[model samples]
Target: MLKILPAKEIYLQGNEHAVLLLHSFTSHTRDMKKVATSLHAQGYTCYAPLYRGHGHTPEQLLHYQVDDWWQDVVDAHQFLLNEGYQKISVIGLSIGGIFTLKLAQFEKLSQIIVLSVPIDKEPAQLKQRIIDYAYNYKTIEGKSASQISQEMEPFHHMALDAMSAFQQFIQATMQQLDRITVPIAIYYGERDDASYAQSAETIYQHVHSSTKQKRGFENAKHLMTLGRDQDEIIQEIIDFLE
Candidate 1:
């Protein structure tokens, strides 16, 4: 056993303005921890939920589908409502950004902030990333080269199915971008893939919100919150929310 510590959901209570922090796919809630804590310190209550089958072994992750993660996103929002948070803003990364758009279609949101969201579907790239995530997870678990190879043998087919479902979800969400009328801010790293910048532009052009803004950080990449410009990113988010 490599004794890797598992990630968990984060809930920090503050004032009435609630912020839902959503992490990227194949990532943990810890990815949103810094931003969550910063927001909490600024008197904004924050909740970051761990999606189903995440924060565990990659084999466990493969058992859950995209639909399951969407449900988790919904449940997390409802939880804040139950906690008496009337003014709710959502900040999401990657697939979490897609869920935010989907939620905006049916729910009332105060603000929407999305980072590194993918607008165009690249099935081959997405599948390869999923496979790479599995291999990385097994490596972290202290598996040998031969064992990891054998374990990953059965995951190719499953990865394909997962990728298909993910593409469908993205398409469905993209179709409803015009339904979102809340104040929206989109950010992408200049160093990230061009798809993210394109996604930001597409989202900005599609949303019906009058107060929409898009920006890119030069010192950042796919994971902006963890990038070199993290402090600047946090400050920008606070400025937007305020």
Candidate 2:
């Protein structure tokens, strides 16, 4: 396991109902901290696993496949099952949200909350954008490129091979969306640049869930959990889970 700095993995024991939080691609478990904490406070056991090849250097990420990350979630699910949690809900961000949808196909989940899931988008283009941003790392305020990259390393950049694996996962996940049968709460940022605004509607229209809800934030971006209206988003998740 890669030692993730600043924010380590979280596993808080609570009630029989458990919430599995998955962080975005290239993002560490820290990004899921607020959501996990909120769920844990509600007397629910919360487990946020650090996906394989994530929470480490970009170079390290290139060495792992997308299946490894998905298997990480599978392992976490089995762990929760072994712990005797009867109910399991999943909440994820971006690629994490995509993975959540994929897992819902096989796991008997209670509910799923997808935040800024990227559908109807080209993964290759997104990968190129990341490369562009990295090669042309800009100085923010007064911070140099090196300083900025260091500060944002945990959540930025994807190696070429990793991006290819990500694209494969995205394609397979999209094709299998109709397999989801549990209640779903889909949230997307209206002004999201990483994921198009229409992707949320596409998911809502395609999902087989009879109990589905959608929320759009006009001012928020892709990282809904870390955005300004995060409290509102978290409340929406909690309300949906109930």
> Among these predicted structures, which one has the highest lDDT?
1
Write the residue-wise lDDT of candidate 1 on 102-201 in tens digits. 8888999999899999985766667776688889988988999999999997667664767787888899899889999999999999999888898899
Estimated TM-score for each candidate: 0.96, 0.84
Candidate 1 error regions (>4 Å): none
How many clashes show up in model 2?
Answer: 0
In model 2, the clashing pairs are: none
Runs of candidate 2 with Cα error greater than 4 angstroms are: 1-6, 120-123, 129-162
Clashing pairs in 1: none
For residues 9-127, write the lDDT of model 2, one tens digit per residue: 89999989999999987678887899988988988899999987666544455466678888898999899999998899999898789889999999899999998988744557656
